[model samples]
Every structure is written in C-alpha cells, then in structure tokens.
Target: MASGSASLMWFRKGLRIHDNPALQYAAEGTKFLYPVFVIDPHYMEPEKNAFSLGSARAGLNRINFLLESLADLDSSLKKLGSRLLVLKGEPSEVLIRCLKEWEVEKLCFEYDTEPYYQALDFKVKNYASTAGIEVFSPVSHTLFNPTDIIQKNGGRPPLSYQSFVKLAGQPSSPLSHTLSSLPLVGDVGSCVISEVPTIKELGYVDIGQDESSPFRGGESEALKRLNEIINDKEWVATFEKPKGNPSAFLKPATTVLSPYLKFGCLSCRFFYQCLQDVYKNVKRHTSPPVSLLGQLLWRDFFYTVAFGTPNFDQMRGNRICKQIPWNDDDELLTAWRDARTGYPWIDAIMVQLRKWGWMHHLARHSVACFLTRGDLFVHWEKGRDVFERLLIDSDWAINNGNWLWLSCSSFFYQYNRIYSPISFGKKYDPNGDYIRHFLPILKDMPREYIYEPWTAPLSIQTKAKCIIGRDYPKPVVLHDSASKECRRKMAEAYALNKDLNGMVSEEDIRNLRRKLKEDPEQEAKNKRIR
Candidate 1:
C-alpha cells in the first residue's frame, strides 16, 4: 500500500459532490483524500439492472452517465485538491488492494437499498473493520428514510402515494446545494482521464437512430434542466397533458432527471433544494412546481423502502393484493422483450424503451399491462428483468413496486384495474404521434385510427397500407376478455389465504385450489392459452 494519507470516498449510485453525506463526512475527516469508484460486481455486473441509452443500450448509457458524472466530479474534486481514482473488482477485494497503494484508513459512500449491493456493502465494511479501517454510510438517496416514516397501525407502509406525500413535510434548515461552491484544487494537477466506452465495449451492437437528444450529465446539467423544466411559463401551466405525448419531445413536460437520479449525478436534496429555490425565490411567482416535487418525492419514497427492506426487489405474497400463476411462454415473453408485440401502441412504447433505455413513466405501465394482461403469457419478473437491464434510470424499489402495482398486486387488483387499450392510446398519445415515431409499420395509419389498427376493418386496415398479422400482429388479446380472465385468476389467487385480512396459513394453496376446482370453467380459463 502506498503511504500517502488518503481517505477513500467511494462513489456508487450517489455520484454528486454537493449535499452528499459520504462526501461531506470524508471532506471533514481528511484534507488528503481520493474519491474512488469501483467497477465492481454491483456496478459492472448487477445480476439485473435497467440497461439502456439512446442508441447506447442502457448498460452503455449507465457507464456513460457514470463516466460523465465522474469527469464532472474530477473537475470539482480538483477544485478541492482531490481526484477520483477508478478501479475494478469485487468491492471488498478492490478496497483491500487500494490500501496497498494509498494510506487509506477511512471509507465513505452512500447507503443502498438493493439486496445485491447491500450484501457487498456488508462484506466491505466487515473487512475494513478487521483491517482497522473505518466505514461510514450516509443517507442521500431519499428525502426521508423509510425507518423514519411512521406507518399507520401496520408494519405495512402507506399503500397510497397521495397519503405518503401529505405527510412528507419540508426539510428543516434547507441545505445550500450547488456545484459552483466546491473549492479549487491546489494539490491536484493535470491527469489522464480515459473516455468511457459506449455499448460496443459492453458487447452489444448499437441499433436505430441515436435517439438520445444529447442528454447532458452532472449536477450542474441536472439543475440546468430542472430550471428549464420548472420555469417554462406557457408549458409549465399545461405540463400534465403534453408531458406524456411524443410530439412534445423538446419541452418534455416530464422532468428528464432520471439518468442523473439513477447515477446520483445530482442529489435528491439538490433536486429538491432547486425546487425550494424556484418556489421561494423565482420572481416569476410560479407555484414552485409543487406538482413536480410530488414526483421527486415518489422517487425518494421508493429508495427509502428498497433500502430499508431486504429482498424487496422480489414480490411479497402479503403485499400485492393479488397474484396469479403467470403463463410460462418463452416465445411470447421474448417478443414482448424485443419490442415485437405488434400492437402498434405497444410496439411503439417498447421501441422507445429499446431506443432510449427509457420512455415516459406512464408508458412503463401501459407496456407492462400489455405484456402481463394484453397478449404475452409471461411472468411479471421476466418483463421486469428486461426493463431493469434497459432502463437507464431503473431503481430496484420503484421498479419492483411499479411492476407489482401493475400486475394485480394492490387493492382493486385485477378487479377495477383493467387498462382500456384504446382509451389509453387516445389519452396519452391521442394523435398516434408516438406510435408513428417508433412503429414504422403503422406509419401510414391516420392518427384517429392508429390506436385501434385492428378495428379499422380489413378494408381500412389494408387501405391504411399495413396488413394485420403480416405487417403488424393483430391484437394479442381482446381487452374485455383478457381483463375478465385476469380478474378471475387474481381473485382465485387471493383466496389462497381466506384469512388474508389476518395472516397466512400452510396448505392455503390447497384451499385455494379446492375453490378453483369447484369451478371447472375457471380451471379451464386459469390455464392461459398463448
């Protein structure tokens, strides 16, 4: 180990320098310190992750975001007489190796919620403790820790989001957070920085146009985008509507902070701090983007739960109100995973996911519903895994919660939760603008008729210049029939524990099966035909 005095500030998902607990503590501890990022088992090879970038696959975009975030950090760190050191391996193995090159006694990094990284964290901390080194973890992922939130008369957290928001009060003595405040580096000097690789390095060929609209990285850029989004007058007033449409791309009514949030390029504190600024100080007297803050709070809430609960990435039998045996059809699952479901709206949403490693938030539900209920006889986890690998902003907590929510997991489970395929398209992409952009097969269809291409009649479907099943697959499942079948399955599954209102019991499946067997018609329907 090198003998120079250096406190290693390890960077993980939390990448920003400002208002960060790890960075703050490390800065207070040692003047001579090095920021480090381990391309370890967790970051480099997450068992599953949201993978995608524009033309850059999510795996590629993630590396790119981290690289840009690190580059920005190096610039800021140089201002602070420090530079980040990059290394690879299992975190424990790599940190042990770092001790040889630098006189490192203390390690600092943000806390995590995912089980995979948490296990790695436990190993590293134990090793550091035995080696007489100190390890510190700080909360930077969420506004309030899951432990801190008080649930109502139940171990279960609040089931509804609106209820969660009502109780999420403002933080006291709001912290000042901006990238410009970092100090200049006198001890730091010019150093070689290698460019982060694109998807090719990750062993995937690029596809389609570079749909990435030059999304910038770093805390400054995140704030810049935040300001642009929150401050736009004409658009800000009407954000809720255009936010989901494809035609409104540049003004992207949605806050495009997912990549930064994923990489922690900007702290949630900083993001919220920016909102406080816009709300309190922006002379325009705008409503402080309270509507926007609600979304960020959701981001914080998911992180809090994921971090506090182990094995949360997987489903809980108790939490989701309903779950059924999803069909095990690989071909259908693959088609959905590869963006070939053939329903133009569904395909368009998947293509955006394929092209950008992201799609608007609502699109996620629409597409997931189409897979779980519309056509594909696949398990939710199958789709969830694909989404994790491709989504640049994928967070385990949010992803799991969302998938569970959409897959008949909560109250009103499959009962009142059927998404009308036609209604959904008209509501979000009314003009078929999004479909035309991603699904070329339906490019010639009129905006009004695009949502229901199959309904256009054989003559009209042919006149629209696309042939059903040949050009685009016909609707995989009828909305009414599919919803009814899905609901029955969900109700049967919930019957597994008749005491669900109380607690679970063994052989509950047998009891549920007995109920299912009594209804022969349901048994036949239960066996999904793909």
Candidate 2:
C-alpha cells in the first residue's frame, strides 16, 4: 500500500481489464507496473496420442482462443500506457526470478481455487514472503469465493443446486476502476520477457485463415457479445434452459458466451450486473434452475462443490460419485468419440463438438447419456476427458460436474430417465437438419428414417447412397436392450450402495459385480431383500 513501490500484476485466468480487482490493486500507488502473463510449458506440450487422457494437452481451438485473449489483454493494457509481458517456463520460478531481478516490491494476482493453481500460488507466495515482497490476491473469476460460500453453508459445500442457491446470496457488485494511465515497466536487470507467442511458436500448427471458430476470443468480442445479448431485453427476461433448441445451429438458442466466461475474458460479476439490469425492467422473469441467471449460478455451484470435494474429477476417491462398474471398452468409446456410433443424432453432436468446439447443453446431455448409463455403459470420466480436450468452454469444475450429472454418477440419481438418442434430437429437429449438416451421409436419407437410418430398406439406402453398416455404421449397441441392461446394473449398484448406507467402495462394487456374474439367482434374491 506504500506509494512509489514497484508492483507486478500476475495475469492468470482473469484476462480482462474491466472490473479486475487484483489489477486495480496492483495499479494503485505503483511507480512502475509490470502486467505479466506466464506461459507454463505444462499446458503447451504435444500429446503422445490424440485420445490420451489425464494430460494437460489443450485442443488447438482452445489454445487459439487463449492466445487471442492474451493479445486483447495486452492491447487493452497498452491503451492505458502499460503492456502484458509474456514469460515462458515454470510459473513460480519465472515469477520469483522476475521479482528479484526487477526489484519488485509487491506481487498481485487474481485468487484461483483450482488445486493446481493453489499449489503454484503457495510456492510463489513463500518465495515472495522470504524476499520481503508483498502479495495480494483477490477473487474475481467466480461471482462469490468458494471458501465464503462453504463457510456460509456451515463448513460444507451444499450438494444440491437449490441448497447452493440459498447459501449463495446476491453476489457483490462489480467494482469500477477507471484509469487515465498505468506506470510503464522500466529497468529490468536480466529477466527476459516477450509479447504473446504465435501459435506456431507454441508448437501448434498455424491455424489457416479459413480455419477459425465463429466464436472469436477476446475481452472486446466478449463485451460486444454481452451487449448484443443484454440489449434483447425480452429474450433475456424469458430465457429458459429447457426451451433452448439443440438443433438451432444457424443461430444458437443460448448465449454462446460460455467460452468467454470460462477463460475469464469476461468478468462474471459484470455479466451478472448486466443481467440484473435487464431483470429490473421486466415485471416477472424466469427463475433459477432454468433461467439465464440460473445457468450462471450452476457454474458457481460447480465451482463451490469442486473446491470443497476431494478428488472431484475422478470416481475412485470422489466421495460424492457412485462407484458404478463402468465398462472399459475402448472400441465402444472410440466409436462414440469418432462419430461412428451409427446413431445419427448422437454422432452429429460429436461431430459438432469436434468441429466447432461447442455444443448445445441438451446435445451434450444426449451424448453423455449415451456413452455412460444409457447405452455403451462407458465411464463418465472417459467422456469427461474428451470434453475437457475439445470444448472451448471446458472448465475443470463444470466439465466434471456435468459429466457426473448426465451419467447419474452423482448429483443426479435418476438413472432410469434415459435420453433416447433417436427421439431426443427428433423432438427439436424433426426434419433431422442438424444431423444432415454434421453428418452429410445422412443428408439424403428420408425424414422418417433419418434418426434410425439402419431401419431403412436396402433399396432406400441405395437410393440415398448411404448404406447403413457400409457407408455409415450400424448402431453400435441396440438402444432398448443396452439401456435396459445399464439400468439394471445401475439399480443393482444403487441397491448395494443403499444396503451399505452409501459407504460402498470400488472394491465392494467389483465384488458385487463379480457375485452377480457367478450366481444371478442368489444375487437377485439378495438384491430383492436389500
């Protein structure tokens, strides 16, 4: 807080200048300001295999989005007489060295709840403390700090959405930090810093001029999109999640600003304020668990749970996750991933996900259900990994949380309510236009047989030039039979869990499954008793 002290503002997820509390703190009373972003190689490394899991490999689309956001941040900083200094290497090491070499008196950054960042921050804080450098971190990425929400809920994260909403009162209003200028970075001894790296330099194939996401990434673009959505007062007032059309691709039913939010390119508080402004003008608006505001709350809800829950991403040690015996069939998973599932509806969603790096929430539900408790009986973690790599809006907390919900692994227990891959898409796009757009092989297929192309007669297949089991694929698993089997397995798991008072372990689940295989009659009798 001393005047004329040097400050280094560390930029992580909080990429925007507007309503950034940490940035404002770093700028205040500083004689020299160095706005810095670290590019740790952990996230930039190339994957050994395309489908490799448990790695930090980011898809090119997301990487490109990140680069664009950093560039935009730098541009915004430059307009205020400062620039973002992009540093490469391990974050703690680079930051500590910079602190000493530049003689920085203070270090400030946005508070992050993710365990990875938490550990990294600990190291940096320790080094800064030893060197007598001041440290300040303010929560800005999420609406409310997870720790505060947990405290309000009596030392535990509220599991249910309704419970979470009650604990999370109105979010604090966004702060205004208008600035005429910022002090320029001056006189570093030997520390190296550069502008944001090009995609090619970061080891990605240079994105071609034509190969671009329709959703451009930057704070400028985020604000423009936010304004466009907010200006439609009527739409904002009545927007509901269930009413959104999954097949409306030409113009999506929902705001597509999730990527901006995920990357902190747009401040969550700023967006919340904009939504509140719209709601004040309307007489009565849609409420939570469905409304547009509800969607944002769902995001915060996941963050709170993830922060409080141990091993939140994985099933083995995740306390909330049910130990369902998910199959380890790579072939089934590959079929689902490669868009060769033979179910046109499910495959088309996957195609959209791969190509566009975005999908409607309902579309996500359909595929996630198919891969897990609905049909293939694959693990939700597998699907979670795929989404984490592909989705432009993939957040560690939300991605895992949604996969768990859709799979009936946790949060949601209604495993019997399966999303029919065929009927789900038909309800929204009866003509199967969404399928046709993504899967051109199904374009000429008749409308009646579009959702289930294998049912088409050989003559019809020939006429359409898209033969099932030949050009396209036959249905990987019969939906009715597979879903019935999956439900039975889920019931057995749930019953066993109930008998154990929800204290079932991974080994216990495996034992039950093994017992069921060995003596079906005995297991059935035991299940009936339980």
Candidate 3:
C-alpha cells in the first residue's frame, strides 16, 4: 500500500471504471498500474459438437457484447493514460506470472461469489500471499455483498422476495471514484501484454458484427441508456413489471438495461441511486416486487439464494428444488428450441431470442412455462441450458433461479397457473403484430386466425397464403389435453413430496422418476383402483 509501489488490477465482470473500488485502489499512490483482462480457455474453447463463435455455453451475440465492452473499457482507460492488457490462458496461472514478471506489490480486483471465480481467486491469493503481494477484492457487481445478506438473515438466504427485501434493507449509495489520471504500466521486464483480440482471433469464424441487435455493449452505451431512461422521471416513478407490454418490440415496455447489468458495464448501485432520485421527486411511487427498484432487489435475491444453495443450477441434489418426474423428450425439446412449436405466440418469442439475444420478461415467462409444466413437460435443466447459451442478459444465478421458478421446481409453487400460449400473448398483442414481425410466414394471416391459424378454414388459409400443417407446422401437442395431463402429474408429484415430508433425497427422486417412466399407466391405474 506504500506510495510508488507497483499494482495490478485484474478485470473480470466489473468491466467499467466508474464506482470500481478495486480499480481505484490499484491506481491510487502507485508508480505503475497494470489493468489486465484474461481470456480463459474454459470460456473461449468450443464444447463438443457445438457450433458457435465461442464456447457453446456462450453464443456469438454474448461474445461480441463482451469484446465490445472490453474495447470500450480499454478506450476509457487510455483516457487516463493506461490501457487494458489482454492475456490469453488459465486465469490463476496467467495472473501469478504477471505478478512475478511485473514485480507487482499489490493485486486488486472486484470480488465475485461465483464458484468458478471463487476457486480461481483462492489459487491466485495463495500465490500472492507467498510472494508477499497484497491482494484486495471489493464487491461491486451487485448492489450489496451477498455474504452480508446471508449473515443478516441468520446465515441463510431469504426464500421469498418480501423476506429478502426486509433483510436487504437499503442499498448503500454509489461510490464516487473520479480518476483524473492513472499511472502508466512502465517497465515490465519480460511480460508481453497484448491488446484486445478480435472475434476471429479468439478462434471464432467471423460471424459478421451484431448489427441487428438494438443493444450496443459498452460502459459508454450503458451510461447513455441509463440517463435516457431515467430522464423520464414520471415513467420511472410508475414503472410496474406486470403492466409492461411483452409484445411491444420496437419500443419495449421496460428499460432494456439487463445485459449491461449482467456484464457489469452498468453498476447496480449507480442504477439504484438513479431510481432512488426519481422516487424522491415523485409524490408516490411503486415499491418492491413490481417497482423498477424491486427489479434490482429481485436480482439480488436470486444472487443470495444461489450463493447459499448447493447445485442451485440443477434439480438433482438441489436442496430447494422440488423433485418431479420431468420427461426427457429430445424431439419435443428440439421443436420448442428451434421455434417450431406451431404456436405463433411461443415460436415468435424463440425466434426473437435467437435473432436479438434479448426478449421481454413476460415473453420469457411464456416460453419457459411452455417448455416445462405448461405443455411439453420437458426438464427445466434443458430450458436453462438454452437460455444460458442464447440470452445476452444471461447470468448463471438468475437463469437457474428463474428456470426453477417457471418450472415449479423451486421458489414458486403455483404450478396450476399456467401461461396459456394462445391467450397470454393475445392479451398484450391482440393484433398479433409482434408475431408477424418475428414469424413472417404468418404475416398475411387475418387477425381472427393469427393466434390459432389451424382454426381457420382451408379457403381462409389459402387467402392468407399460409396453410397450417403445410407452410407452418401444426401444434406439437394439444395445449388443453397436454396442460391437464401436466397439472395432474405435478399434483401427484406434490402429493408424494408432501407424504414424504419434503425429505426426499436425490436418489429417491431418481428412483421415483424411473418408476414413473417405466410404469406410469400402471401406477395411475393402481391409484384409480384404490
């Protein structure tokens, strides 16, 4: 911590310069400051049989967003007389090497609760300790340290939003860390520091730029969007999640700031402060679980729960997840994933997700419900994987948490209340213009037949030039019958869970699923006879 001591700041999710405590600490009173970002092969390397610009875990859209954000960060740093040093390798090994090579006396980075990052930080800290280098990691990705929330809740994460909000209280104000200038990375004896690599340089075939996306990834863009949205104080004051229109694609009902927050381009605390300012000026405003502020709190709630629970991403061995006999139907899952569900409402959302890597929250709700308890009865894990790869705003904790909720695997228990694929979208987009925009095959279809094209007569279909079962595939499953069956299955699972007093083990759940799969009809018959 001495003046003139060299320091290195490792950039992970906290890609922006503003309100970054670690970056400020690294730059303060240092003779030479090194800002570094490591491209780990774990993320960059392709998965088996996967076709994507990066790892199958991340698609081209997410990769491009990341690269753009990094490039923007580098630009911001250059304004302060420094540049981001992009290195490629395992992070711990890379950082340790940099520490020794650069003769770094102090190391600083944003603290992360993710299991992978935690393990990496442990390895790097061990090396730093032995080398007598000081290490500092400040929490900034989320509004508050998840550890603090857990501790305040008596060493457990609050399961419900109401409970979480009470425990979370008020988020601290954003830190003001203005940097007039930064110390240059001077005299690194043998360390080779490279600039940010292009999409092709990362072993991805250059899928042309993400020109179609409405979002541009960067700190600059993030701030710009925040200011523009927040300037409308009246809109911010009355914002409610349920009232938002999922079908309003051109002008989305909600602020599309999720991707920015996910990548840490926009500081959550900074956003929280902005919302608080808007609320202060208004006579009365919406509150948590629906309000704009509530959205951020919901994000924190998921983070805390994911941190507290083991296997939060998977149903098996997940303490909070309800064990259900979810079917493993590859064909059904594929049809759902590829936007071939035959329901314009469901298919259009999937298509939008593929094209733009973003969608309205309610649209997400419709597709997620359809894949799980609503119609297909596919496992939530399958849906989680698709979201992980496809969404630009995908975060590990939130994605899994939502999948569990939507699938009725955990958190939410209202399995009976299904999102009707036909009626749900009709409420928001009665004209089906949203459907026409994404699924152009049905562009000429009449409004009467838009929601249910199969209901139309042959002559009417011919007039529209879109023949159901020919131009467009028929519905994969009868929604009414499939939903009733799904609900029956869910009720049976819940009854079994209740009978077992919610103490079912992973092995027990596995056995139950196997038994159901092997002789489901016999089991039902036996129950009827009894």
Candidate 4:
C-alpha cells in the first residue's frame, strides 16, 4: 500500500517456501511481499527444424508436476500468513512492470543451474537495478556450490561419478542455511487468481496413466518419498542390485526421487543430510544407505558442470564429449526412435518412456549407448533431444554427459568400452519377462525365444501367431557388426584428427562412413543378427 513497503519474490524452480533462501530474503527485507510464477513460453515453443521442443516436451512432466506443486505452494503460503501472487509471461517483462506499478524495492529468487536461466537472470537483474530493486539469488538446492566441484589434471569437471565422488568427499563440509519465509505482503500487485497451465494446455498432451500418476509432486510429497525409501530401511538391501532387470521396469525398487531432485522439490543437501541421519541408526544392523546417496552425489556433479557453462543444454557445451562423429543414418535413427528395433529390451524401454514419461537410469545408459555407439556417430544431440522429450526426469547435464562419454568425446573418453544391446538383453532380462510385458505381440513366443522371436522355429512362430519379419520389425541392425562398423568409422575419423575440436572435421566424418560401407566383415555380421 505504501512506497518501498513491498518486496517481490519470484518463485521459479524452488517452489517450496520452507528452507528456501529467496523466500526468507524477501520476508526479512521488506514489510510486504509479492510472489509470482512466470510461464516462459520460450521453453514450450518448438525448436528450429525439430518437430517439438524435445527438452520442453520432456519438461512437460515436470511442468505438470509443477502445476500441482504450485497449487500446493499457494495453499502452503496461505497457511503461512501469505499467498503466492501468480503471473505468467516473460519474467523480466512481468517483474519490471510489476516493480514499477507496485512500488516494490527488492527481488529475491533461487538460482537456477541451467544457462538459459543464468542469461535470463542477467537480463532481469539489469531491469531490476534500473528500477531500483535489489536482486538476490540464494544457493539452496545443491550440496556443494557449482564452483566447488572440479576434477584432476585441472580438467573441466569430472564427467564420471567415480571421479566426482572421490573429489566430493575431499571438499570441506557443505554449508547449511537457516530456514525462514517472508511475512505476508499487503497491497501487492493485483494477483492473478488462476492455476498454472498443464503441458497439454501449453501444447503438449499429458502422459496418461492406466494407474494414478505415480509421482506426487511438491515439497511435502518429496519429503514423503524420501521417508518411504528410508522409513524402516527395507529399501537398503534391494538398492545394491538396482539394475537387475534390463527391460527397465526395475523402478520403485530403485529410488524414483530423481524427478523431485531435478525440479528442486527435494534439495540435494537435505537428501544427504537425511541419509546420514538414517545411516547413523542403521550402521550396525545393515549396510549404510550409501547406494542412495551416491546417486544424489551425481545430481550434485551435473549441476556443477551445468552451472559452469553457458547454455549447458546445447549439445556442444560439453566440448570434451563433442568429438563424436555420430552417424546420421535416417533409417536406423527411425527404427531406434519408433522402438521397433527388434531388440525387445530396447523396445520395452522406449515404450515405457512413451507411456510413463520415465525410465530407469540404467535403461538410459543401455539405450543411449546403443544409439551413440551401435549406430556409430549419430549426433548425440539427436539422442539427447529424444530423451528430453520422453524422460520426466531428464536433466541436460546428465543426459549430455553420459551421451558424450559413451560417444568418446566426454571427459571419460573410452573408445573400446561399448554396450552390446544384444548381449545386454540376454543378460539383464534372461527370462524376457520384462520384454513380454511391453511387446505383447511377442508374448506367445517361448520364454527363451521372446527376445529373438525369429529364432523360434517357424512352427513356433505360427503358434505364437506372428512372423518376426511381418509381426515385429526385423532387427533394425545387427549388434556385433554394427558395433565393429561404428568403431572402424570412429577410429578412421580420429586418425585424421584425433582431437574432437578440429581433428575430426566433416571431411573426416565422411571418410569414416565410406570406410564402414566398404567393410564386408561388419556387413556380414549385420545379416546374422537380423
């Protein structure tokens, strides 16, 4: 109601008010407060030449979760002697006009890990300063600040979790901030009384569930999930063998906390703290919850990498990993995309992503490895984009790092270590129970033959009621031959320019492809796999 009386708190990814720095700053600095959520159409808009915003399409799951979270946040604010002032459109545009109109004098918000947000933060900071509003960003989510984590040889950060874990333990104990929230604001900007839009309303459809949406989004739900995983410690024993099955349904038994962690519903700092508290109790009777915290450390590692770069979402920002001359085969790409790759494990994973908007982390590795390595140098961006669309928990740093690592351009550039999806399927899903779940077309085949239904005798195929060629697509490409061809091409390209930065140019890329087409051994192997 009065000049210099109110402060504007922008609610971005850090939706919950508890233990939030920005919210506390807003409450502490001013007599009144205004809270807002700006819908950046920037992410929702389709990409140049791409069918959709792959990241945003994948982002829809979080957006859907956020909508629910925001509603809950609003309710929480109401309980805490205030209410969230919701708004949508460009945040800077909205904030500039709101500051001037409401006579607000300070802006406080949580810092985001992505480059887009950092760039946006700069633009908004300029606007706020010119408007005489002080902007404040708090490091609330990550355990260690971004600059704190880097690797040996003074390289760009460690791309592998093992390296990060070793370095992470050496860091001085992480800082903890006291929790508080802003007192209620009065006479704020005219609050828009409406809910945030859904992914479908924002031009993407909901990832429908035959069951209730498994993810309960927001802070309370996130806390509940953390509790469930460690509640009585039953999950502790099962976690060591997290990737027992390959068909990728190996979830729930595996912690599903990533989505919450990605969106800041659960803070990595708090997650580790909680795990430590539980570990203290269970140290004698059981193994510590080390497996769970190890995964959380990865979240810390990626955010460290993401915050260091500009537009970390861009495929090339992880330059160490960009040297991969990914093959650009349209047909193979299509088969991989459609999930009809005749690899039941791969297909099952793909189908799950389409239906559930989530997949196991190991599944991501298998599929991404198969695509980047098996296909031989297809742009990792292609795979990254696809993951961004389907994975509910997709984060740019993790996706790009793993993609490039497998591609041999990342910090962990190992060329010979490649996953054979054929071998992976046989090993992880030995009985093919996971395969039978999704590719029901192959359900009638013998349990042993489910993965390769074509190998079943023709009579067996008839009893199963489908020919491999007619019913399910043939093996899109053979694994062993495809792998060898991929390696040869990569090696040939690297020969000219061993370094990815310039050594492997377009000319180098072309020569490798030509060599692969000419290699008879690789081609014959393809025939056998099919």
* Candidate 1 lDDT trough over 10 residues, lowest sum: 183-192
Summed backbone clashes in each candidate are 22, 0, 0, 11
RMSD of 1: 4.9
TM-score of each: 0.82, 0.95, 0.94, 0.87
Predicted candidate 1 versus true structure: per-residue lDDT over 397-439, tens digit per residue? 7887777667765422544465566777677568787788778
Tell me the RMSD of model 4 versus the true structure: 3.8
Per-residue lDDT of 203-230 in model 2, one digit per residue for the tens? 6665564444567888999999999999
Q: How accurate is candidate 1 locally (lDDT)?
A: 0.63
Return the candidate ranking by lDDT, descending: 2, 3, 4, 1
Cα RMSD to the true fold for all candidates: 4.9, 4.1, 3.6, 3.8
Residue 105 lDDT in candidate 2: 88
Residues 1-530, model 3: lDDT tens digits: 34447999999898898888899999888889999999876676655665334585687678778889999999999999999998888889889999888889889999988888889999999999998889999888888789999999888888998898888877877777588889987666676677887777776676554433567898999999999999999899899998999999999998999999998999999999999989999899998789999999999999999999888988777879888878888978998998988899999999898878899999999999999999988999999998898888999999999999999988899999999999999988899999999999999999998989988999999999998888997888778877877887789788878888777776766776765557566434322121
In the range 379-489, model 4's lDDT, one tens digit per residue, is 677878787766667676677666666566555555667776656767766777777777788877787777777678889989988788889877877776677777776
Candidate 4, residue 522: Cα displacement in angstroms equals 4.3
Instruction: After superposing candidate 3 on the true structure, give the runs of residues whose Cα lies further than 4 Å from its correct spot.
Output: 1-4, 45-48, 51-53, 205-212, 514-530
